[model samples]
Every structure is written in C-alpha cells, then in structure tokens.
Target: MLCLGAADTGRELCHACHLELPWLGSQCRMCALPLPNDGQLCGQCQTSPPGFVRVVAPFRYAFPLDSLIPAFKYHRQYAFGRLMAELLVEALHDAYRDSPRPECLVPLPLHGRRQARRGFNQATELARPIARALELPLSTGVLRRVKATASQQGLPAAERHRNLQGAFRCVRAAPIEGRHVALVDDVVTTGASIRSATRTLLDAGAGQVSVWCIARTP
Candidate 1:
C-alpha cells in the first residue's frame, strides 16, 4: 500500500517495498535498542535499567518508517496508521508466542490540549487494532497525561526525561494494580516517555510493565 504498486501476493505492502523497510535485527533484551548481538543487556540497561520490563519493536526508526510515522502522526493519515498497526500485530504474535501476555494494553496518553487540537491520539489509534488482534483489553483511562510539556524532538535523553517528569498519572488504579500492562506507542526514541509512564504505572501498583512500539530509534 505504501508504493501503490500491485501486490502479487495480496499483501497491502508489496514485497519490493516491504524489503525496503528498515527491519530491526539484533537488539537489547530490555529497551530493544539495536545491538551487534541479541539476547544481551545494553550498557545503559545494565547500569540504570528502565522501569519497564522489556520493549518489543519490529523496525528501526529509519527511512520509510521515519517518513510514514510522521505522516500518520502529524498529517492525519489514518491509512498509514492502520498499516503500521497491522504490521505490529504480526510482530506481537511472534513476540508473545512463548512469553506471558499483558493483561491490558494502554496507549501513551496525549495531553488534553494536544488531543483536542489533533482530534485524535495516534497511539490510541495504533493500539486499537493491536488490542483487537491480540485479544487484549484496551485501557485508555488507566493513564493520563497531566502536564502538557514541550515537544521531545531534538531534546537530549536527560532533557527528555526532565520534560516528561510527572507528566503521566495512573488515574484508575483498580485495573492496573498487580496486573501486567503493556504501554503502546507508534515510535520510541530515547524511551524517556515510556520510562516515565511505566514508573507511574508501577507506582500505581502495577505488577509489571512492558512496552510495545512499531519502531525504535537506532
């Protein structure tokens, strides 16, 4: 679907275009950061691990994904969002084949002002189909972005973490308490946002937290 070319195999994205996608290879076991080898913790994770247990990402943040994510996130391109979600669904199937599934999926919540201005939350849109495909409950009210912080783009990792400090709060503790929850986002760049959200959920009594994103920055 990305190339608008005929798909002989009946897939939305043709084989040629699919081959061009920046698929993630070996990665850190925790944050899914690209690494030379797989199944090992990265230095960052070893020194100061993220609040989440692990991250599941299928693609690197490059090329077609870099372009496609922006269009879907900022240009209101719902078709592109759906396509990415479908790809994530397939990844999640393999990811959870031997692992325990989360009790619920929570999309990274957008601040009220941002959601109002955008008319939709891209993370929620991406998580909806994944939740349906995985047979997991989608929980939107579990977390809320209380502080409307500055854009994280271009900010260093430390600054990004400071920017999102206290930005997220678990409004409904009943559903999250002692249950494994997966946080969903379209893309994960330094993972500061995910860490902050996971911290909030854990503080709210969640037993464990995992991250699910379509792409991770290399």
Candidate 2:
C-alpha cells in the first residue's frame, strides 16, 4: 500500500520497503530507548525506573515512521494503522517467547471529547487486532481518561508529566486487580502518559504492567 507495489504474500509491507524502515537497535531493555549498547538500562530508568516492568517496541520513531505514524494517527488512515499493528503483533510474539504473557490488554484511553473529535481512540483501534492474535481480552472499561489536559506533544518532559497528573482513573478495578496487564499505544515519546497510566493500574492492584507500542522515540 505504501509503495503502490505488490506486497509480499500475507504481508502489507513489501520486504524491500520493510528492510529500509528504521528498525530499533541497541535499546535499553527496560524502556526500549535507543542506547549505545544492547541489554542495558538507560540513565533515567536506572535512576528512577518507570512503573511499567518493560517496554516492547519494534521500531524507532524516525524517517518514514515519523510520517507514517502521524498519518495513521491524525489523518484517519486506518489501513496504515493496521499495517503497523500487524508489525507490532509479530514483535509481541517474539518478545513473549520467553516471558509470561499479560492477562489482559488495555489501550491507553483518550478523553471523551478527544475521542469525539477524532471519531475513534487510536490506541483502542490498534489494540483490537493484537487482542485477537494474542488471544487476550481487551479491557476497555477498566480505565478512563477523566481529565482532558493539554496535549503532551511539544511539551517538555516535566510539563508532560504534570499534564497527565490525574488524567487517568481506574473505573473497573475488578478486572485489573492482581492481573498482569499490557498497556497498548501507537507510539511512546516522553513516556509520561504511560507512566501515569501504569501508576493507576498498579494502584488498582494490577500484578504487573508492561508497555506495548509500535514505535518509540529515540
């Protein structure tokens, strides 16, 4: 679909195009931030670890992804989103090969007004295919974005964290309590949003939380 050329069998992205994508390399094991060496934690993660146990992202936010992700996210290009989700599913399979799978998948919630304006929550849409492929329940009602704060985009890291304070609340703790949950999103930048969501889940008694995203900003 991207190159107007025939895709590989059972794949949305052709192999040639896929080879050229900016795949992540030498990332921090905990946060998936790009690092000089593999299997090490970033300074931020070592100094103050995030609430989530670990992050799984297959691509770095660069080049075509910088364009493709925004197109899928803001321009209503759902086909592109689906392609990215498929790629994420593949990564999840690999990431979970040795690790325990989460009991449920929770897409980061968008505020009601934002969902109304966008006509859909991008994270929820991205999680649907993953739920089916991974055979995990999609728990949409468990969390809600009660506060509609300013967008985290373009904000400094500190400001981003402040914006997300009190942004999420656990609406249905019964499903989350004592259960391992995978929080799903399209991209992770400053990680302030996911950190807040993770705290909410942990506070609700979730056994553990992991982040799953299509891309991560380097």
Candidate 3:
C-alpha cells in the first residue's frame, strides 16, 4: 500500500507515487521489452530470438525506480529490496496464474569478486522471499558467475553480449535436469545477462527456462 513510503498512508504506494511509477503496460512475450501488444513478440525477437522462452517484468526502468533500485543494490537498503520482491511476487501470481509454475527458482549469480565488493548478490536477495512465497525450491548453488565483466549500463547491445560471454556456468546440473526453471534477477536491460545465463541452464539439461525480473528497460 502507499504506506510503504509514508507512515500515515500505510498503502503500497501513495496514489500520486503509484501514478508516477513506470508500469510496463504491454510487453513482448519473449524478452519483456515494452511492446504495442501484450502477448506478441517484438520485431527484434522475431528476427533474433532470446534463449529464455518467456520473461515477466512488472515495471519499466524509469524515474524513482531507477533511483530506488540503485539504493537497494549499492547502498544495501534492504527495505527497498523487500518491497520490490513483494511487488514482483504479486505480479507473478497474476501473470502465471494459469501457467505451470517452474519447478525451482535459480537466481542470477554474481561473480565472487563482485559479491565481495558489493556485500551481497542483489538477485539472490530478491529471489529468496519469492521462492519462499511461491513454495518453490531456490537453487543458488546451481549457477555460478565465473567471469567478471564491466558494468553493462552504457555498453552497445552487441558489446553487452560479448561482455557476458562465458560469464556464467552451470555448476549443479542434476537439480535442473528435465525441470522447468525460473531465472530470477532484479532488472533486465538488453537481456544479454539473462540470455547468457539461460544458455548455461539449457545446455546443462534444463527443459525450459523463464525469466523473472522486477524491471525491464525498453
């Protein structure tokens, strides 16, 4: 309720703030990129498909979300992370209500050095409560980010893919074999990271992989 930000309001978000958040209205089925229609693939996905079968994101990367996300990730303001996870869970319940839930949740891993610097993997923090609420197993040990790369924020789309090549490895194949897996992350931009991570899961025998993230950049 709006109260999350205001003690007196006690609402998820105040009406004014809620109206200002960039909600993703219609999005591509494959990449969760903003689209003219909700269930259709964007032209780019039609030409060059992503590895993950579907992506579900609730918000657009804009305004206050852009600010709040960094606070959670860089500043360790976990209350923001908890609130984001709660919102993402609510979105998932509605989006996948009729679909088969993934067998387990695999968080997008952070490189050991990066995690040491940041003090936590933001994706793991986001996924833990989601797995608990969904009654799904969380397999953090299944995936590993073996390579560290520069931040992808300003890279060209093609460069982003190159930066993440060989960045991820499937460390535990048995848990995901023949299983539908949901790869969790906090944000998806050009989708290079999720696509690279999903390839590892699929190569290791995952039957299918879907992406779950809080925000997507159009």
Candidate 4:
C-alpha cells in the first residue's frame, strides 16, 4: 500500500494510495443507492422524483474520508481537498457509461457571508480539482444560496429539510437549458442540499443533472 508517509510532500498521496479507497459498489448510478446487482436507474427513481438525475460518489463518508473533510474545511488543510477530488473522479469514471459528458459542474453553494467568513467554500475547494481532472466546464456562479440557514449538524432529519428549504437559487432563469449538469458537494447529509440544488437546475431547464461528491453521508 502507498502510505501518506511515502508520498511526495509527506501529505499529498501517491496515485496508487488514492486508488485503494473502498468505492461504493453496484449503485444505481442515477440516485446512487447501492443496487442488489447493478444498474443505472432503479425502480425507486423511476417511480418518483430523484431530484437529481444521478449521483456519483466513491466513499460513503466513512473512515479516513469523514475525518479528512473536516480537516480540510475547518483546519484549512487544503491537501485533503485535492485527495477528495481525486476520489470523486474515480467514482465518476466507475459509474457513468457515456456522455455528452456533463456540460458543466456546479458546486452546491454556500451563502456569501458564510463563504467569506470561512475564507473558502469547501465544496468549491473540493470541486476545483475534480473539474481540472475531468476537463469539465465549471460554473461556480450557476447556483447561489440566497439564505443563510442554521447548521444542520445536530438537527433531526425532518428539521434538516426545514432549515435548508429555499436556500439556493439559480443565477439565471435557464442556466442549464438543455444541458447536462453535475452538481458537487464535499459531503452529502440527508441529501438536502443536493436536492435543493438539483431542483434549481431542473427549473432552469437542465436536461439532466447529476450529483458528484467526495463522500455520501450514510
């Protein structure tokens, strides 16, 4: 195994180490719920609203990744962001079959004040490297969070939805018109943020929208 200790900067990992993560297996590739076998969209997504067309994530917000996100977000250790992006790319390649590819990537936005105070949007940080890796167009301004809501950390699942309701807005009426979009975030908890972002994209005329993230909270 390629350990962090054996890496270039003693922090950035070698490619071999990055490839070792336990990627989510046999997910629907649409909603990202693990499949009994493997398929693109499941019966559940076919029956009802998935909010987003698909989701791509490598890790389940468990183990080393869970800790690494906080380390990057709260501690400003930007290296973790790069590692997370690498993992996200792995997931995308593992999941999707074909594409006009996504026309652009939109990181789930944080309200302006919070982003300023934090010195960075963690989602943006995570998305940057992935966009570079994938050579995909990235529109950071495509989605904006108009309202600043309370942290969802300790809130009950039901309350989490309430806290984030109507929190995001599309920059224009039809930003994603007839284009495929991939929405990104660092970690998805309850999928509230992604759902809100996806709704905005669909309303804006996106033909399809997918979610790609470093981790999924489960």
Give the candidate number with the greatest TM-score: 2
- As for model 4, its CA RMSD to the true structure in angstroms is 3.2
Once fitted onto the true fold, the runs of candidate 3 whose alpha carbons sit more than 4 angstroms away are 1-12
Off by over 4 Å in 4: 1-3, 8-11, 14-20, 26-29, 34-48, 173-175
- CA lDDT, every model vs. true structure: 0.92, 0.92, 0.90, 0.76
TM-scores, each model vs. reference: 0.97, 0.97, 0.93, 0.85
* Comparison by TM-score, 2 against 4, better one: 2
Q: Which scores greater on TM-score, model 3 or model 4?
A: 3
Shift in Å, residue 85, candidate 1:
0.5
Which stretch of 10 consecutive residues in model 2 shows the poorest summed lDDT? 1-10
Model 1 Cα lDDT, one tens digit per residue, 87-178 = 88888889989978999999999999999998899999999989898889999999999999999999998999899989998899998889
Model 2 lDDT per residue over 1-218, tens place: 66878889477878889888888988999999999999999988999889899999999999898998889889999998888999899889999999789999999999999999988999999999999998999999999999999988899989999999999999999888899999999899989999999999999999999999999998
Please provide, for model 3 over 111-149, each residue's C-alpha lDDT reduced to its tens digit, 9 standing for 90 to 100: 999899999999999999999999999999999999989
* Residue 122 miss distance in model 1 (angstroms): 0.5
- Cα-lDDT of candidate 4: 0.76
